[model samples]
Target: MVWTLPEPMLAEPVNNPALPPGFAAEPKWDGYRALLARYADGRVVIRSRRGTDMTAAFPEITRAAASLPAGVEFAMDGELIVWEGGRVAFERLQGRLNRTAAGAAGMAAQWPAHYVAFDLLRRNGTDPDLTAQPYTARRTALEELFTDQALAPPWTLCPSTTDPTTAAEWLEWSAVGMEGLVLKNLRGTYRPATRAWRKYRVAHTADAIIGAVSRSLTDPATLLLGRYDPTGRLRYTGRSTVLPRPLATTLPARLSPAGEEHPWTGRTFSATWGAKAALTVVLVVPELVVEVRADVSRDSAGRWRHPVKPVRLRDDLAPADVPLFGDDTTTSLT
Candidate 1:
């Protein structure tokens, strides 16, 4: 029987990324979840999490697979990433996805991609299925495979640790694009698309001054948030996700209009760039501060990769207490 692309094993949230004595921790990379396999004839196939056949879409990666350790002619699981400028650039991957064979070669030279492998699923061209093997046994084989190959560029051996302390260290290293941490039970067996494996995603929190409100000030949908620079300029940081009804209803009474001195007095704010969904704001006094939960992927202008959600009303926080990024957390969430 021919081997098919098995569903990637999934992760459930745990408060901590650390594992028990028999478990192990691996750095969760911020990139596409990919399953890769190579043939006896040096042909390779790649598949995305959604099951898209990407063999022709990543020619360079196929070539690199051909160069993997001898006798490693089989299927494996890994994360495909574009590492650049000392960090994994998720945005850079857009250039390589959905491209033809001709286009892939050009993009490969411009923004090369690498596979950070951590799991072994099959050996020798789809024979000897390793899915039923204990994680400990399979992990041992995975490491030995990398050592045998003297793995280099476009083929990275993912770092794994049995020490919780080391996992905590990687969680705080999101500045370099560490997605989070993955914890696997040593005795667990590989079960595709299952939550037998646990994952802890990194989330950061900061205070945002509520500088503006949505169209329905009396019961607004979202809050326009900003932070002050060293020069005390209230620059637009980003917007918040929908506010709870109770909070939204009471916001109008607390906000006062900015007559003329507002920095965003005449500026337009779009919820998303090039997106038809635009929002107009009524600049208010930048007096109220709210706590927001966000991820590390930020825009060139320092806004978050996505709209942040308000953690809660921050009556204890002041504008001075609002931080401007540069904080790391070890906490994990689903």
Candidate 2:
């Protein structure tokens, strides 16, 4: 009797120490999570992580999936990133996912999102859900099936390497903002929704002396902040978060003016940070000594992205000690 296959399992984070040496690593692309499903009848479906049907939202991609090799059904996992003006416009892809008909159409014409297919969960006459099948076998089958298709939002297979140093270099020099690296064992089989894989993320922090404090926009409280690269010649590297509440109250008087520039924008606003968005306080002083973690790679405007989280105060650190870039002092908490 023939056994049926189940939907492919997704990878989740595991203990950092579980990552053994010699595993292949690839950049974790930042974009929408999608599963491409092609039925035996040639019908295609694109489902979001929430199980929402998105085939209509990405018509061009649907057409592309239909062009895959005949007599095979496939389920592939990947992201849809729209490249515009020499940079990946994640916001444009978000607009498409939100199902704003006008907005999606405009973005599609301006910067269509590309379907980056990476893994094949199902294919040919076989059900890829069999837990015993190895990952290399599935990958090989996927490459052979989709090698000839001309899909819209074109498809690119993400490459992997066993060299951590090379992988680190790729993460640093990635033209598009890369989340990090996914390390997978070559001999491992597909383990759905399990911690069979490991991810090495690139996190950063800068040590800067406390310079000033700013009043929080939503609350009566203030935020203790600091700045790096106080020369005024270099653009703002990024702003540090407030000190702990106990320290924040007494921070104002002890703060010394590090530079002339104010760290806060003096404007109260909220913005998205990584997977979540929150209200943030902006200041323009360099008085506080603190550290911030974030991806500082250049955006479309040539400015670094702001800090996602300010870990803590670094009272022992000095302003001059901060490296402008290429310093990886922040240890991985993962």
Candidate 3:
């Protein structure tokens, strides 16, 4: 019998993690969405959310899947994450996600990935088209599989609960790099490639210095933000998405350049932090500060994991008021 995996269930965006009653909430892991399967022929495959084969990219995961209890043919859906320092370390994880067999071994040993299964679609070659079944039933099946199989280490059952209170507690986890929460209707069926589930991420707000801009001081597109560390070195935190039209035009006029003492002077900036390509940018004096909406996860270098959203100009607050680190998540400024 030819074994095939079910399509991935995608999530719809929600402004907040509020779920209506009778729904279930799970931690929205900040990692790759993948499906793990074990075939009767002893073949193991780990596929990306887009259905691309990723077996060679994560040899360790394949080895774990192959070690599953013999005679167990199963397919599961979940997130593949690499945890470090008690948080989801996405930047470190990315180094392994796209690597070839030769480069993968090092990453696996350094930051081993964990497969957190959320749903069970197949067991013993049985169909039931778990997609057609309600979420509660599928969730039950997933729990049973974990219990019966005694799944260990690399194989983990994703933490889930129907209680909204418990999920609200998880929202606080964003500060330490937890991605927010995902909510699904108890009766909702898994719809492949459909946004049937809802995801509300934990957004963070903090202040950053305006180190650089997209264009010259005359007109700018986005703000390149930075923060001063304990050593007094200005490091790039992250960039904000394009500003509103008014700010993009008027703010450039207010920025002044640091003729000699500018931290970023003579320093080259990338179009993106990790990318090799450089960007043509007009560096500005780091006196002006602005508040930005950012994600909880940070790269190993202490930069925001994603481009932040510019909230407003903090003209009243001095640059010193801005926290040296962006992970200071307890502030109520928002």
Among these predictions, the greatest TM-score belongs to 3
Please give the lDDT score for candidate 3: 0.81
| lDDT, candidate 3, 13-59, per-residue tens | 88867767999999888888898888876799888888788888787
Candidate 1 local distance difference test against the native: 0.78
lDDT of 2 at 56: 76
After the best TM-score superposition of candidate 3, give how far the Cα of residue 159 lies from its true spot, in angstroms: 1.3
Ranking by lDDT: 3, 1, 2
Candidate with the larger lDDT of 2 and 3: 3
Model 2 regions lying over 4 Å from their true place: 1-22, 69-72, 128-132, 148-153, 163-165, 207-268, 274-290, 296-299, 302-307, 311-334
Model 1 residue 323 CA deviation (Å) reads 4.2
Clash count, one per candidate: 0, 17, 0
Q: Candidate 1 versus the native: TM-score?
A: 0.79
Report the Cα RMSD per candidate: 4.1, 5.9, 2.0
TM-score per candidate, in order? 0.79, 0.69, 0.93
The 0-to-1 C-alpha lDDT of every candidate, in the order given, reads 0.78, 0.58, 0.81
Q: After superposition, how far is residue 129 of candidate 1 from its true place, in Å?
A: 1.1
